[model samples]
Target: MATNVLICDDSSFARKQMARAIPKEWEVDIHFAGDGVEGVQAIREGKGEVVFLDLTMPNLDGYGVLETIRKEDLPAMVIVVSGDIQPDAQDRVKKLGAMAFIKKPIDAEKAREVLTEYGILTGA
Candidate 1:
């Protein structure tokens, strides 16, 4: 089966960028969510096995979503994709059970790195 990925970001541009960056060979099933609330709902609805989450959102920010996921025992690996490069922010998200932290302006190389790190993309 193909790996599934959920992208949650408020910016349409970001979403488009991410869509393009992910390698086609991976055959990933991508799903988009405009905010954390929707992202959480999508996860609950069995959208994906991994989530690309944005930290700064209007409603139910990434932290809150992570907390909810942890509290509810949701089975998904969350990779925080955000522009917030602050050390504290990254640390907090890491503590919240995020599988990885990926900086924004995502590129194909970074996407591949993340997937490989999580064992989602194989064949080194």
Candidate 2:
């Protein structure tokens, strides 16, 4: 099955970088959202099964999106991708229901590991 994925970040560069980092073997229907509001909306619309979410963004932030997802019981696994490597930030996201927290300059290998660990990816 092709997984629906969302990349939510204010920086176009980050979004593109994340898109590139995704393994081609995942068979994802990729979508982009510039902020948390759009990310939440995309989740509501069932456009995302897995989300790569940025912490700091204009209009809405990643935390807000996670909160919305939890409140609404949205069916998307959020993986936080942030420049802030603070342990506090990581804990907060996890408490808010993020499946994983990855620091800035996402590593493709780590990304795959997270997905695989979460049972979102298997095999190749």
- Candidate with top lDDT is 2
TM-score of each: 0.95, 0.97
* lDDT tens readout by residue for model 1, 1-124: 7777899888899989988888778867899999989999999987858888999998889999999999999988999989999999999999999989989888789988888877888884
Q: After superposition, how far is residue 90 of candidate 2 from its true place, in Å?
A: 0.5
What's the count of clashing pairs in each model shown?
0, 0
Number of the top TM-score candidate: 2
Residues 23-108, model 2: lDDT tens digits: 98889899999998888899999988899999999888999999999988999999999999998999999999999999989999
Off by over 4 Å in 2: none
lDDT accuracy of residue 115 in candidate 2: 90
lDDT of 1: 0.89
